[model samples]
Target: MKEYPIMFTAEMVRAILDGRKTQTRRCGDRWAKVRPGDRMWVKETWCWCWKCARLNDPEWYHSHDEDDPSIQLDKCGVKYAADSNNAFETCDPMNPKTRKEEFKWQPSIFMPRWASRITLEVVGNRSERVHDISREDCIAEGCPSQDWYRVNGGPEKWFMVLWCNINGKKPGRSWADNPLVHAIEFKRVKP
Candidate 1:
């Protein structure tokens, strides 16, 4: 079975750990290879001073204890502790020679499946524009609709900014840009 290493922000990780998130959007090109039966291993970007840490200042980087693999594994395995397997580091990002420090800030592409604690079975998937995502799907993306869009505005409005940010596109990439996104629905599974 094909497997994917899916990255999640810490907030979304918490939501997923809480069993509230069920859907996610990925760039169409990136997700094109994901089949319905594939499995997704969730990787959480550490919560830390990303901006400062990116400058190579160790102080900022270590402030949150993000370097500890066990911590990340623990954070990722919050809900699925029984199924978590840290005995083997995934091969994708780690060869026996890969230093532990190098794994700390490697991009998601380098994250190996074995690093994940949460595994999801892809139940369904569809292609749609960022704006085409429904309010329900937005909630699945971890937005608390009532609080996030308290005004007359709704999830779609809020989703626009979020979509742009995640995609690293500037604003106005909204429905006007009509960026293609793959909406993937999944169920938590025993790893």
Candidate 2:
């Protein structure tokens, strides 16, 4: 099976972790090449412990070598934002901090393959107009059920709002525009 890295937002990561999300839809056929049995490693916000210890200095890597023996592998490992609220590191041998601190969470796009903690196996793929998404598909996309949207509208309305929020500003991608989308159905295969 082919392997690919798929980026996910913190919210989407949470949804997948919580067993609420099993599918994703792109504005176009960007994921068209993905087929059943393909593996997707989720890319989420994360930081290496050594980087976190350096006060999250963005350019810290330029000065230090990751393979340097001085860098403790145990203390300089990868930390995922979805798994913890904070990351702790022993920066000083003399005076170590007792509490954890929030990691300078990197963007999902910047996450490396080694930092990915979740893996998904593609089960299906299809193309359809964005407006054709059903309530079931909405749930698969991590939206609340129709009952949850009863106060405001239907599940479609809720999904429309979410889709617009993510794609409305892009040219020809708004819900009203009804752009064809590539829908990828997957199941979590690894933790």
lDDT scores in order: 0.63, 0.76
Which 10-residue window of candidate 2 scores lowest in summed lDDT?
90-99
lDDT of 2 by residue, 1-191 (tens): 99988888777888898888999888655589899999999999887654334644547645666546454443545667777743454444333441245344688888766667789999999999988888889888886655677877876777788888878889998887899998999999965
Give the per-residue lDDT digits (tens) of candidate 1, residues 22-69.
888877487977888999888754222222123245564466554455
How many Å off is the CA of 55 in candidate 1? 23
- With a 3 Å backbone cut-off (N, CA, C), the pairs that clash in candidate 2 are none
What's the true lDDT of residue 145 in model 2? 53
lDDT of 2 at 188: 96
**Candidate 2 global CA lDDT score:** 0.76
